[model samples]
Target chain A: MARSDDEYDYLFKVVLIGDAGVGKSNLLSRFTRNEFSLESKSTIGVEFATRSIQCEGKIIKAQIWDTAGQERYRAITSAYYRGAVGALLVYDITKKDSFDNVQRWLKELKDHADANIVIMLVGNKSDLQHLKAVTTDDASAFAESNGLSFIETSALDNSNVEEAFRSILSEIYRLGSKKALEKGSTSNFAPNATQTIVINPPADEGKTEKAKCC
Target chain B: MTDDKTLFGVSDGLLPGRVVRLGKPVDWASILKASQDRERREKEKRDSSSSISDLKSSQTSIPSIKPKSKKANTVIEESSSPTDGETETGKQRTAARENSSSSPSATSSEKLKQLLAEPTLNTEAVRKLAWAGLESEMRSPVWKVLLGYVPTNLARRNDTLRRKRREYQEAVNQHYDPYLDTKEQSVVTNSSTYNRIGNEEDVTFRQISVDIPRTCPGQALFHIPEVQQALKRILYVWATRHPASGYVQGMNDLVTPFLFVFLSEYASVKDDLSLLKATDLSVFDNADEALSNAEADSYWCLTALLNDIQDYYTFSQPGIQRRVHFLRELVARVDGNLCTHLEDEGLDFLQFAFRWMNCLLMRELPFHLIVRVWDTYLAETDGFATFHVYVCAALLVTFSEELQDMDFQDLVMFLQNLPTESWTNREIDVILSQAYMWRTIFGAAPSHLQQAFQASY
Candidate 1:
């Protein structure tokens, strides 16, 4: 089920989702590539990048998926939500409406992503503090009520860009390691196949009993 | 049509005008302010209600950040830190839109924003006003020094910084005060939140749907106005200079930093990655629809740039060849022999420089810092072919000593797996500057750079 590093302690898949101009691509570039642009082209399709991180001597590789945030493109991108352990739901802090659309994104996650997906709510473009509409307190409180992790950062200033990824990677690692421990001894996850295997009673048992009785 | 030479203040005619329109946008400030006030009050009213407006731009109506479904909230809570405080917000942008259409401020701001976005349609006043705003930015010292004119004298730097701060303060004040602001130099803020019915939402939604965020927009010819104009002039120059491949789609992004640099005096503000990407925009056009609208001259200029890149593209597209060649440049700079050694491995070349050649160092560094790297790339485009290689060297600098114990595969993975926060500008500068010095010492540089150094750069 894993590639690249079973030798390592952990691996995580984090998907980045947001509106086109809201800077999801820029945020991904800022995280995976460490680059930002005042003028960034809107994203076209899913772009994935991998980077291994050292967490307390255990190396964790982040399989980061950058998805198109456009409404129509979600049809193609919806397939990407599967198997993801983490999602960085990004929105532009300067644009209030983008901040408001977080619920729909969360719903989309619920519908498509794993049942236990770790979500981080990022209000991007923190460098544009002068033009700030969404306050940190408001976003934080919202996160509190909805059970999502929150951080307001500027991809431009490179603020908290690393911490965001680090926390998500480790969280995924913790979960994956726990799952590994839980299922490592018993083979892989049953996916409900356990019931089918455990009750594989002889189909001819009834026929044999009838023959004996006769 | 305004000629490029006069437009750029270039009397010698090295840069000609693209005659792009500079129209004034309608003032959307009042409506935006009113809406902001209303939103602020709404926040004050509920105190707990978090509106997801950004969602509206990407999603639709009355976005509630809370996932209404328990299954949604459960997955989030169980998976993340109990402290991961970010909540779900849903934008009822459509509702706001309905209300905005009826609001007087909304109508006017929308009109103004419309005027500003279109380069083809404009009133003459708008043109003068547009040029005036740009001109004002030209005089604005903070960004003018973005060209990186750091004064050697601490006193002068302090003076310049102070003067810039004061001027920014004044400009900001003028932005607020209608009377104090000259009609000629009005800086519109809170511009009516772009009053297109579904333009912002549609555009952003379209972008996200296709997974554009995780990928490169491939040279950014669409969004930036300055970039569009720069492509236009380069198109003109290409028509006269290298007409075979003039004005290709991706070329605009490549020239943007140069346009900014050409406008500035010292070319000091270090955002070389942005500068580099801007120059590299001429590589190819990914969006065919966008190409239909582009000027013919621009297409040709782009063609010329692409022609030299024929060899690399013979396999596919030549734009990426620079990624590899530039890797050589970066490695040679870091430890001339080390990069060469790695490259000579030959058989599995992809094993070592795949990431470097792939993302162009985009995956390695912070956004603005990339811009800083681009600033340098713009200045020395030929020698500094691959900008990210410097980023790679910065990440791997410790490798020289630390990795002496590790194998080559580990080295490549370590370089590939490096984190953004690991390196710094000082580290990069040390490598790049050394690379710069190393090259010039061996007679690789043009005399102009030497002259510039002699004159005290």
Candidate 2:
């Protein structure tokens, strides 16, 4: 499972961040492993998992980093945001406090993450409709104002979990391809620049990119 | 025996004359049944007239038969267990009798009993004995002294325990009661009010509640309602008292080893905690005083542990950062090739070693091995902070060959999910011995590691 796969067309590093008990870890597991446990342990440091999804006719391997959602963990978790190309800002629907903390989480990403990192504001735990405190309209309006893509997912019922990841990966792929095109155009555009658009490609390119980012 | 050879085959080069004994393959079903039968007999005796004498005789005999066989029994229960209802009384009796005579665990239990029985507890002697490894039956009281939760003088031990336990209960009432009662109302109010008013008590309570059920998700023990409530109260009380570090995420994992060890004091079967059913925990429900005592011990021991490594959970967690740095340098000095291989693959020590230092490898190893590891950690001079870096270096070096062959992603995943789920005492003994050897070599001369790193470059 550790071996690098040459088969992926692109690899996007995404992060999951939110307040405590907001289902960030469950969302990561539900998306990456198609597994969910009601009693999943709170992520202490950071957890890493990878899954390949078909997006825009390309295999986009999403390397997801799940972080502890406690406020104090930002000292360590913020570093993981440095090179992340995307982020899933998650919040529980039943808990108004988690949803209200979305603004803080967004400011956190703005502080630490890349300027162009694609973000999707995810209102999770849609399964608990009766106890819901945050409405879809409020979260949607919040996402729109912040210029982030929006989705409501239930990692428990497997609702919109896959689509949530697919949309974000596809958005990242679009932005990455655009960035590669612009870079290629200025530096004597090659005919095969499309094939070289893999984000943080392995070997020579991977080494330099890692050194620069990390 | 052949299976044991293939399973825990690694030799401990650091310790001489330490024979790693492999008892006959454990029959968990019969053992479980035997334990249950023993519980029934003990209960029947308690209802009878001669309960005290029978209890004393049974306690002495049970430990002799139990410590060795039950040690192996827990490893099996943690990893995999065979089907029950297969009565092998003959084989079970033979294995139990052979284990009592042949297993070193029995002898260690005897030695610990004698040492702990001394009027004035010999602190150094107990530390040395416990550093080797603790038998399940002896862990509770041994840990109480080792962690200094109980006084060394036997005359004052009970008084000290009563006072500390009462203080803990008071702290819980002062901090946790308001949160429990006003939890819904606080949620109804804006969360911004919490930040503005500096009422982190609500936030800390929420975090602890979320983490309690998640503490040991796989184990039924933590899932018991009483256990979960106790954990929440312990963590919440501790966080409230220590404002500087106030309830970090990894502190939840630190409490489990203590709770498991201390709670064993109340169980009928001391060796294998896995045999304990949720129904058995009813004792705690009925005897509220006993339950509170265990909770108080867990809280105090956790406080004692975190007191030594307070910086690890402080704002920036500088202690863990420094430890991770030291681990990297130590690994480079110990195994330059593996260190270079990791750097070449873009693997930073913080990427993996942070969790190792944070949870003390509790996340990587299974519950049984973690308890065994803590037997040594609590015995360390600096309370496992300085010595733990050496252990982390030893663990990395042990996997040097396999880690060198993997890529960055593979390395992180492999290190995070180490294949130690099925590890028995044999593997743990080797790792602890290796950790001790490295600590002895590099622990005294701090400059030796720096000089070694510079020379390698």
Candidate 3:
């Protein structure tokens, strides 16, 4: 489906890394296909899904790569870090072990991903409030200290799933725009500037163009 | 009860160890007549109960009398006649009970060993009866032969292992030579050149590297460098060879059972797998020799398995989608009411069955039982790819009552994490038997399903 509707201004590779059973695959499915699985098995190597979004008037096609969360999976997942412009560093809110491994995941990103890759600290499974082990305040503070954006999502309940992707993509787009302005035409912004689709609507059709973004 | 106790006491000791028959010798005609009468009575009772309960939960009772309603309807029609099919299931259960009473390991090993020795044995027949489940000790060799890791010819088996091990080492040696370098400049230079070939190899190598350590992190045997590198080499080589599919995430999981089973063969202590953890060099005493052989055996077996299901891992993953589609249709045909309930509740087959089909139900069952399931799959005609659809249908049918009762979220969650860790060989047998029944009924690609498949495409 993503392949069929491929008219996009920008293609950003966003990697999802977290602990096993942290629901990275479900999150990706919920966002891309509008589907989620409660019986989500541990990711094997790497699985990718593409979804296009309108961010800052540019068609941004987000190619999200979900990686296995186990320590050894880093071997293969680290390779996926190449060409990634964004990283969704996910941890289960109900799982303290998953939350504790966020720092290690951050280290993995730093080691393998691009230096300027936008990182998001996502405390997923927010719907499981009763079983919540990692508090929102604590996760937000941790994200703040680590210089990363933060969000809480419930893929099962379809809560914050869309906003999480939008936030990350918008952030990546803003950074790309800023970098482009500084360097003028020769901006070394991403893997490709040609891939980014910037639609310039006529001034009179502004309202319609804005409505078309979602 | 006192007479039974006296009879038990007369048989050597109070507990009959391995050699004892509980039934007395009866005339052949009487034995046949007795089973027939019991089967007839059982069928009548089952039919009467089903007719009474059919109105309330038509789908729920279908599995109980599934054999009778094989050709009934596309919507799980009620049985037309109670005596439509033979009560073979009752007989099979009795046979299975008898088999369990005997020495499981000794009898299974003997049957399998004999079958292996026969040059012209019907493997399909062997796989259908008793062989679906095997003894622990018999698995290593049986799986190796089943997966085509070893040649069926006895004379060629040793030579095959020798050549494959040598080839595996050569590949590992050549590929990992850069990692062995001490100097920084050479490593960088080599990496850049490696990148020049295409980033595919580098990505493959890195993916394998990360996944190997993570494959089975809790298991100490996997932590050892020897085991880790072996997994790495096998995965990397497979990815390199199959550029179209490359390395998907789940392929790593498929490789584990083979490696564990192969390594088990070389481990000195047969019963206790934990003893292998005591050694640092390798799990087995022969160290590198056994490790390399295991690596080679695992690599080939994994390759064979991927060859059968490679479409699932390809970039587009149409294989999984097709299988999932087939499962939906299969479920509709086999348990129409449950299928209708799922449709009403907005439950999709891909939500849970994708993993079921992709992993060949490996994720659902534990390691010991996974092999047993595979034993049946490997024996069937395109069992992994074709027969698996029925297995998925059978699994869904098992949860029909609960699925109908639950709402969307609960159903999705429940399907995602069916508590299967405690599932033993018996549970697998039930699922497999039900799957086999479905296969006989709807194995042929029916016209309705073909249209559904085409419409989706």
Candidate 4:
């Protein structure tokens, strides 16, 4: 379920989607809770956890959704795309197949997801630099062409894990706030859409949503 | 069937693991009865799905939006079971089964008929054979797997034990040898050590492998020939329905009992083969074979399931750790209060919960007694959550009376060995029931599994 935690300024539904063994769940575990399980079970369905962080003076509650990667499970999982604000399209840098499968995953998102879902290309397991298949330049360039934010991370070593999530959240938040300012008292918020929009915030733009009711 | 070398004289190449002493033998008729009952139940379940579909159609007019994006929502990590809505992708694929043109989902009787095909002592049937190590072929298949895993070296090293095992084997040989004048047993030996043994007794020593199963009961159909036959057919139907996970190594073990009970419909055989084939079989994925997967994929998931809780997987399945970690901490918490309590009591969580962790109280309980456990478990998915807590509370309460007098070690041993008794004893049931009611009232445990069903998509 999408959250609207009235007390918080922002509610972000962030999804971790990637290849079967690219460590999407691990990244979520590391960023949201700073914990990891070496022998985690193959996720059967969907799992969720929430953590709120103070970003730019607003308590941004990141409602993270972790999903199973098996091809068949997708039938049951596709329904979770409703109202999601951010999608983490992850891949294992060490394995090329996972990197190659990214496009299929993207197509999956495009087919059934909200049109304006903000996606980030995350090349995870960066610690295996020697076995790296997908390079930062290649991924970032792909991200540029596809309009996704790209970053490399190693959940085990905790390298840039937080930054990747933070970058995506900031991008989503900026988009959300700028969206509020542009709509100018209209009921439209871009969180439900699938396109990327420029968020040029006027100093106090986001405060309007919370203050308007008051 | 091969009469000499293990079956038509064909050697299994690998001497299959020793059998577990679980008792009795697979009663082909009883199993057939259970199979029939299962077919009826499945038919009823299939019948139920229509109303569910009617309900679902009204509620969800918009086909689920399956974006090509990676993650959709927070799903329970352990979702082999199909949802009530029956739209799980795995199910859809299996329902589109090519092999079973009639579709097991469509007919219950046909599924059972195929399941009851006379057992051929092939590699698959050889798996069902007994070892003197375990009492009989009647033991759960998983137990046979465990007995087989007992470190082969240990069996070879212990001379006294080897002698006892050999004597027991000789006894069984004598009885089956046909020239025997009386019941053959170890007692006729020159020494008295063999006299302590009985026909029903099984040897006790270190066990090698013990992966615990999900706390859901093994298959629990009832006892009637037609019903049993129907269920056997359904088992095969289910197997064909999920061809990828078809006939997995350990599945027959977990499924046998359910197949057995469902077979006991005690009603007229429906002969509804087409309807039986309609079952959706995609949702299940076994951790062992993860069946039909490329070795790479199977190893990948199996490693995930078995690797952590590391040693637990070495002995049992990984799910054991979720509660064992909690219980271990709980033991530490209580014992920390008084080292003397731990020292005086002489308790250790692993030894106590080792087998419990290995088989989830299933192995420890007799087959017949498990029906009640299944009844409760099927009613709720978190049955284990409730069961584990009640076990903790009961262990505490049972010993709470003599809390100070008992040494921690002795207490731990008692707790560890408690489930291995001849019968479950009333306390375990009382405690399990209490936990179930308490949790039902208190609210289900706050875990991903609880909120999973209602999650979006």
Candidate 5:
């Protein structure tokens, strides 16, 4: 039996950004659909998917925007970062250049995303251990230096894929609840508060889903 | 490199020297002619036994246009009648067909065959006829001519193909083959300079290779190694030649229809092309020269198609941006309720229609329907760019009722994964007809779209 994905206590807009062919799309598919494909096409423009996960006894629906990772496409993909509350900066461990380009992707987030966006540094393709180019300690040190949470994942073999998403969603939830507490607005924590961080509120009829952030 | 750039009139300042070599002008007219004769003989021999049955099957398989009620016919004539004075004969023919009981598909196919059979093809007349739909038997040659890959002059067609095909092969050799050889050799030698050059080329090559298997993954033909190699070479060479845009992802999808259409000319199957399989490689076996010719044609035809919408793939992709903007405005004007519904749901046009504009709805519609849609797109004066905006608006409005019932997530998923799998020619015809009607109405006025169109030109 599937839980009602439509009924959620919160909606978080997360973006997946990285260098081309670093498995950003596969990661999104593996997380949202619980499926993966080695033959997934290189993403063009952007793709969207959503999956609801339980956090703090509440349903947190994750709306993930999978953007094309090519350098040129940033002109278009960056525009989608405006209201995102979280980001997964992914790179293939088998490719050194993708790891090197992590700084550039971080700069892109700084330039386009919200100031409080929770970013996770993901070194994907952990299944390709023999060909690993970016080691865990190196990426971890880099993540620490940049103040970004770090995780290694294999969207191919399902290793750390679930944990990576759940960890980020929980981190975002913690930050949001802390902010709500700071504001002294217990209403914000109510089940139906509907105080969405992004876009306008939903109509009275409730026919349209609210495009929201944490 | 400077000399090569000067020779080719390309002053992009970004091209690498070794990748800029132009093919030496070759006199392959005799070879091409001989091959053409052989192909004709083979086709004739193949067709001789099945010609009658083939004709009978084609006639039956053609989705006959259902005779509309008198009122509907009048509305269609009023709305769809071509306004161009140049297409007077075509207009009369359309009118005559409305009055008569003649099958429009057979008539259009006959008209296309006649136009193509001309010593000097009348391209404008052919476009008018092909806009409705293309005859399966004549689509290959007609598409070549319409795309300008082959010449209008019957005498120059062979020579043009020979030169273009040779140029494509040379381009692959210059840009692709040496890089692969060097990469393999560099693995052993560990030369830094070779590594640098290999890395620069590898970015595009790797992306293309990763995408080739993914392009039309459901279609077995793309899974064949030989077919994948051909597609890779075409995309790589195109990317190399056009460094400004390089290899974009959606381009991989764009190449499929052309490759399939051109390769279909050689396959034993014709009527039900969806039945073509990866095991059908037997047709291409030992036919390297013929296969390469098909590959070259696909390259040039794809080039011709992309040339009109080059901005769609360039840095920033301003072409797609403008078209997406146009779609939003067009939808707002055409169906204000649908537009308000989407806006109220916080569903930006870019969120859903970006793929529609980027992939030319290839991601939305199925393979076969897309080819049929391309018939009108290729026939359009702008080669599917501006007219595509209107088509997208029409498509969105087609689903307005269902879209209004959904929210942002459902709308995005529904639009992205439209229930177009079961769509056939009948549904496509309606979409295209509505698109044409919208273009006719909104295309001429000095509206917002007109201003943008003028600025773009």
Candidate 6:
């Protein structure tokens, strides 16, 4: 009773986290549903939505979880960290405190999430240039030092929102393909192996495997 | 009459005389406390000139049956009599009622007591008082009674409190024994219980561990070690007992208002949190007892509230999904232009409204407004679940003009940071009134939402 559109070659669980009021939910909404609100309430625990994206002839389903940014919510939100192959550590560019807390968030990811979790340091609310507190260069430098990919996005204007998702998913895919390659040629074993990789994504797989069904 | 500007004005001072300055981050709890003191003093001054017999006659003749009910609690009288001067809790009850009869501001409190004291307890009357906003001192008792946490019978209420507090302590002690054992042994002796492996306990326990410190981390009272542990125990027990919904993230935020309000019943922390030294709390002779009572009250009220909207926390959150869908449709019918505007910008109700529905808009509104709103919510039959849709719609409609002008990025920014801290009881009244208007137009939740709600549960 599931829709055919739900079928996918790979499923990657991604999580969005940062300080409270940094627009994590809005970013998830813009990416998954292409919608924004002027009166969005703060996230409570964890909410997830799935969107399947086309990646080099393969349908990669992104099961993105948007989490509460408050400190108390970390308890409930941390439970969602397991099995996440990708994380978007979003911070409001206007709030220096949010950007400063990025390191703390990184430590959280290291402690609870997958060790090789594809983390993208997202400076959200990029449209609020007039109120920018964390400069692009500073966040970029921090991301480089921490070995995280960096991008600026405005979930409001839909700026870089798609690219943010595409970039992370593609990065996750790239790493996954590489791992598959190193495992040697095993076409029969690829799909099952890749399916498990959705949670703990493998490091190599250049060839994109297309499922025979659907 | 206090000028609206002075009472709820946008003052530039660090501390205003009697009103909460709009747009400034004032110590909200202090303002509530200050207002209470002012009302009491005013009532005392007015009552001092009246003959003692006249005061007694007014107390007996008033609609409230509180005096008769109080006589049932001999235990309460014995415990409270010694501390009468310091607490004035008993005298305050009489003053609270008499003040209500004399002043327009205490009208809700007077009506609330009358409704709560009836043989069966008039739920309809309580709901109306909730809309009107409860008196500061009366909210705790009113909420407990409304939520069915305490017995309706006056004689049974004290005994019920005593029993429930004991039950809560037992639950906490049992769950915490393993952790305490490991602490004393300095070894992983209780691994079976302590190091849970992928069971329901481990999952929810880990959640409570991380969440307890974060719940209202901004507040001084919540920062205390004792408060944190109590919150942890309360949430953990709630999650364990309710296995179906275990511990969810936002539930932490929901427990705080109850804890804050209930704690204020015993302690006299200063309004200015910065001034509260750690040593000040030691002054309370029975802080542990007071805290346990607060914990029990918070747990029960939270359970009552969650029960009304349990579907929202269930797996896949079908309740929220349905509510979001309904909100979107409701907006379309109520404000087609604004709804279409958001649609053109590719905005949906779920992006913002989901939190509104999940937490009953607690995240959007400050504690002051939230407490006032909750008074009415506890009164209404379906205030938290169904009626909230209208409130959300009314809230959104207030910003239609700005929303109509904003693009996607602007919409997202504006929504995530709405300027609601400045909102007073007046604004909330307007929102509630407007919500009632929408209810009149649309009736109860439309057919689709009903089906979605039914299907989820």
| DockQ of every candidate structure | 0.04, 0.28, 0.05, 0.01, 0.41, 0.06
TM-score per candidate, chains pooled: 0.35, 0.79, 0.56, 0.37, 0.79, 0.57
Docking class of 6: incorrect
lDDT of 3 by residue, A1-214 (tens): 3233346666667889987777899999999889986645467545656788887666777777777665534554576675677899999897775787788888888887667788999999999998777889999999999999999999999999999999999988787776662332223423233222111111122212211122
Q: Please, what are the lDDT tens digits per residue for candidate 2 over residues B14-127?
A: 332123444777766776566456434433432333212122223222212221332232232222211244224423532343344444555767756755664445454466
> Candidates sorted by DockQ, descending order?
5, 2, 6, 3, 1, 4
lDDT (tens digit, per residue) of candidate 3 on B1-457: 1222233221232121122345433344653454456445554444443222123123221212222121232122223211334334333323333344455445656756755654322233244333346665666777765554554444445676776677666766655544522322243223454433455565466556545655654456766777777777788776766666777666777887788777877777675346334346544778777778888778777766666666676644667868888888878877899988876664556656767776777666666667667776765546677778877788778888878887543565577667787887667777876776556545544567656655665
In the range B172-199, model 5's lDDT, one tens digit per residue, is 7777775564564343235454544556
Better lDDT candidate (2, 4): 2
Give DockQ: model 4. Answer: 0.01
Ranking by TM-score: 5, 2, 6, 3, 4, 1
- Residues B1-457 of candidate 4 have per-residue lDDT tens digits of 1112222111221211221122233444544454345434444444333222122222222222222111111121112123344323222222222123423223323322332232210111222222111111222222211212111112122342233234323433432222111212221232344344432211110000001111122322222223333323323322322223222222223443343232212112222222132222221233222111112121121212122222322222234444555554444434444334643332334334534544445444555445434433322323333345444533544455455554432343344345434555244455444443433433445544333322311
Clashing pairs in 5: none
Off by over 4 Å in 4: A1-7, A181-214, B1-457
In candidate 6 chain B, what residue range of length 10 has the lowest lDDT sum? B12-21
Q: Taking the tens digit of each residue's C-alpha lDDT, what string does model 1 give over A1-214?
A: 1334333434455689976567776777787678887656444335556566787666665656676565644544565565567889988887766778888898898887667788899998888888787889989999889888888877889998888888877776666665553322212322221111111011212111111111
By DockQ thresholds, what CAPRI class is model 4?
Answer: incorrect
TM-score of chain A of each: 0.78, 0.84, 0.83, 0.80, 0.85, 0.85
The model with the greatest lDDT is: 5
Arranged by lDDT, best first: 5, 2, 6, 3, 1, 4
Whole-model lDDT for model 2 versus the true structure? 0.70
Model 4: lDDT of residue B390: 41
Per-residue lDDT, model 5, residue B325, is 77
* Each prediction's whole-model lDDT (CA): 0.43, 0.70, 0.63, 0.42, 0.70, 0.65
Docking quality level of the chain pair in candidate 3: incorrect
> What share of the reference contacts is kept in model 6?
0.07
Global local distance difference test of model 4: 0.42
Candidate achieving higher TM-score, 2 or 3: 2
Tens-digit lDDT track of model 6 for A1-214: 1354345666677899998777898899898888997445456756656677988777777778788876645655676676778899999898776788899999999998767788999999999998787899999999999999999999999999999999999888888887763332334333443333222111223212321111
Q: How big is the positional error of residue A54 in model 2, measured in Å on the Cα after superposition?
A: 2.1
